[model samples]
Target: MKIGLYFGSFNPIHIGHLVIANHIAEYSDLDEIWFVVTPHNPFKKKSSLLDNYHRLEMVYRATKDYKKLKPSDIEFSLPQPNYTINTLVYLQEKHPGHAFSLIMGEDNLKSFHKWKNYEIILENHHIYVYPRVTKETTETQFDGHEKIHHIKAPIMEISSTFIRKAIKEGKNVKPLFPENVWEYLDEMNFYK
Candidate 1:
């Protein structure tokens, strides 16, 4: 199976994320797209994040209907401030029968070099880059590289941060996320 890992904090899984994942699964050769809910990202502010389990549950609720789209808690058991390289290495070792690829947006590519063992990741796994609404489709030095593929997926300007802000401001964000996710948020009184 060709599994593409879509890693994120998912502070709350929003439509933008689902759109990208669905697009990659439907349009690309990947057999499955797993939304790897990271427990903690080294680069992101820890204070801004919700509880890891809450984030994971939101992902599960959001992606439950799609057979090809699944949520993963792989990073939860891993070390804190998880790095992509470590997770990829562990996954490769465990799932030798399956092929894995990295799914990311163009914004991540801009700072790809700063990631831990990024060169090793590029050499060992394929990267599918999707366009982000706010980012320009500028060519990176590795744009034409064999391991890096730029896919033209539909871009949504919405973000988890935006959704959180809207919710906190007493704005109805029902249309920004999957139905189950919004219901969970409402029941839990999240971001309010």
Candidate 2:
């Protein structure tokens, strides 16, 4: 099986996340798209993130109806500051016969070189790059890389950070993400 690993913090899985995954699953050659919810990102500040379980729960609730999309807690059991290379190695060892690819935005591609063992990841796995609000591309870095596929998936400017800020300001976020997730956030009073 060719699985596209959409790794993220998923502070709160929103519509943008869902749309991108759906686009990849439908348009790309990937059989499945897994939302690998990272417990903590090495490049990001941990203080602003919600609990790992809470974020995982939100991902689950949002992707419940999508058969091809799944919420993964693989990073939770791993060491803190989950790195892509380590997770990929662990996953390959655990799940034999399954080929793993990476799903990321153009923004991440801009800083791909900064990631640990990025060259190893590029050589071993396919990377599906989708457009984001800001069109930052690392074309020079991966100009002739056949493993890197540029997808014309629709880009959504909506972000989890914006959603959290809006929710904190008592603005309506129901339209931004799945209704179930919005309800869960409302009930839990998250980001308030």
Candidate 3:
């Protein structure tokens, strides 16, 4: 099986995430898209993030109805401040029968060179990149890389950060999230 790993903190899994993952799953050659909820991103501040399990639960609720999308807690057990290269290696060892690829936004591709062992990641797996509204251009090295595929998926400008901030301000951001995810967030009083 060809699986695309769409990694994110999913501080709250919103509609933008679902749209992108669903688009990739249907439009790309990937058989499934897994939302790998990260426990801690080295680039992001841990203080702003919700508990790992709470975030994971939101992802689970959001993706449960999608046939081609699933939630993964693979990084939850891994060491903190983990790198993508390490996760790829561990996943390959655990699921040898499955071939893994990456699903990323154009913004992330712009900074791809800075990731740990990025060359090795490119050598072993393919990348499906979705459009993102960013001011910076992508790295020249990745412009026409064979392993990198530019998927014509929707440009999702809605961000989890924006959603969290709105919720805290007592604004109605209900349309940003899937029904179940919104319900869960409301029930738990998260981001308030």
Query: Which stretches of candidate 3 lie above 4 Å from their native place?
Result: none
Residue ranges of candidate 1 with Cα displaced over 4 Å: 135-137
State the displacement of the C-alpha of residue 35, model 3, in Å, after optimal TM-score superposition.
0.3
Please give, for residues 29-48, the per-residue lDDT of candidate 2 as tens digits.
99999999988888889999
TM-score of each: 0.97, 0.96, 0.97
TM-score of candidate 2 to 2 decimals: 0.96
lDDT ranking of the models: 3, 1, 2
**Top candidate by lDDT:** 3
User: What would the per-residue lDDT of candidate 3 be over residues 61-81, giving only the tens digit for each residue?
Assistant: 988899999999999899989
Clashes of 3: 0
RMSD of each: 1.1, 1.2, 0.9
- RMSD over all Cα atoms, model 2: 1.2
Candidate 3, after superposition: displacement of residue 85 in Å? 0.6
In model 3, which range of ten residues has the least summed lDDT? 132-141
Evaluated with TM-score, which candidate comes out highest?
A: 3
